[model samples]
Target chain A: MMEEGVKKFLYVNRKAPYGTIYALEALEVVLIGAAFDQDVSLAFLDDGVFQLTRDQNTDGVGVKNFSPTFRALGDYDVNKLYVERESLEERGLTADDLQEIVYEDEDDDWAEKPSIRIISRAEMADLMHDQDVILSF
Target chain B: MSTLHTVNKSPFATQSLLSCINHVKDGDAILLIEDGVYGAAAGTGVSDAVAGKAGSVKFYVLGPDLEARGIPATRLLEGVEVVDYAGFVGLAVEHDRAQAWL
Candidate 1:
């Protein structure tokens, strides 16, 4: 259950994963913040949208493929994953190119629902403005 | 409700500190961590820029990061406050939000 006075927390990701530690470190903060039962939402823009792309193989780079970890965020009740529409288009990707992360809606007899929400840049900006705490990575 | 800006890179190495200082508003607090602690030292090229903002913006450095980098508290700039991890958490809670300049 969400506690009283749960603030809207938004994590803005603008960098590509693997090239820097920002994406991974930002994921760590999201997972930790889940325990507080805050209104958590993640926004992927710029190269950050690459983090959700499918078939990410890190074997060549000799690093662990942490992309799969994003799939598990739904289990922690963190399901508001927003991907900017323009970001995906600029990178030559579509919703079909990304992983399908879903969550079981307990309020509706455990029906599966999509967690990733593809929104426009203006909508993403509005979401950012609505947040009480914005964490950028 | 001031924003807490965290910089994790050295001024000599990256422009993260400079960019953070440029964007921070009045009453915003800046915390230097990791290699960023180097910016808190006195008499550096970046010191003058930091000093100019001392009146409006507050400056802080991570104590553990400074120690790990062999920077003593005495070497820090006059307005720079050294904070431990606990103090780091306090600043996050004290401010309205935190922006990490990675």
Candidate 2:
């Protein structure tokens, strides 16, 4: 549970979603944190950027793929999704390269989509200092 | 010139401990926190590896974590300081940088 009046919760995601539980766990944490009405932001770096990549397929692995769950975040009131610019460039992906975000029509996801900023790792690290609770998953 | 390296997981858990120690400089302080605290009570294997890693780094552990985990202060390796959270924060603010090995 989050503390009262804790505005800033920085969630750092540093692993590939498919390979491990790190990304799924991180996404779950952020949604839960937002449900508690805390100010939350997510930073995707390292292999974590892959979690938002285009067309994630887990069917061949004989398990549920969680890529689509990210589309449900807006419904859960999670709006602050950030991606490191350098990470995308390194992975040869851009905003257009991402999968079609299937969010609810006529929802806050539109207004929130414009606020999804791209930043550098250094910028992300500096932002960590101001967060009330910093969790790296 | 004191640095505390905090190692929480069992030695075999991950490569975080070795990776963290590899990057630490001499005279740095290392504090064992969370799962890293378990490393201190394990055995000489950790000490030998840490000594090799500590070019000049010192060792410290959070007293709260140790006690909560049922690991006694006396059971810790030589030259390891048993301190609290205030001490841990002091180290982070005192030192030039802090890197978590988890």
Candidate whose TM-score is highest:
1
Model 1 interface DockQ: 0.23
TM-score of chain B of each: 0.97, 0.81
Interface RMSD of 1: 5.1
> Model 1, range A81-112, lDDT digits (tens) per residue?
99999879988999999998998888899899
| Per-model CA lDDT versus the true structure | 0.87, 0.68
Candidate DockQ values, in order, are 0.23, 0.09
lDDT of 2 by residue, B1-102 (tens): 333445666666765565456545556677888777776663756767765644466778888888888998778877767888888888887864444545
True contacts kept of 1: 0.48
TM-score of candidate 1 against the unseen true structure: 0.61
lDDT of 1 by residue, B1-102 (tens): 678889998999876787567656778899999999999999999999999988899999999999998998888899999899999999999987777877
Which regions in candidate 2 have their CA more than 4 angstroms from the true location?
A: A1-4, A100-112, B1-101
Model 1: docking quality category = acceptable
Off by over 4 Å in 1: A1-3, B1-102
> Best lDDT goes to which candidate?
1
> Which model scores highest in DockQ?
1
Query: Backbone clash tally for model 1?
Result: 0
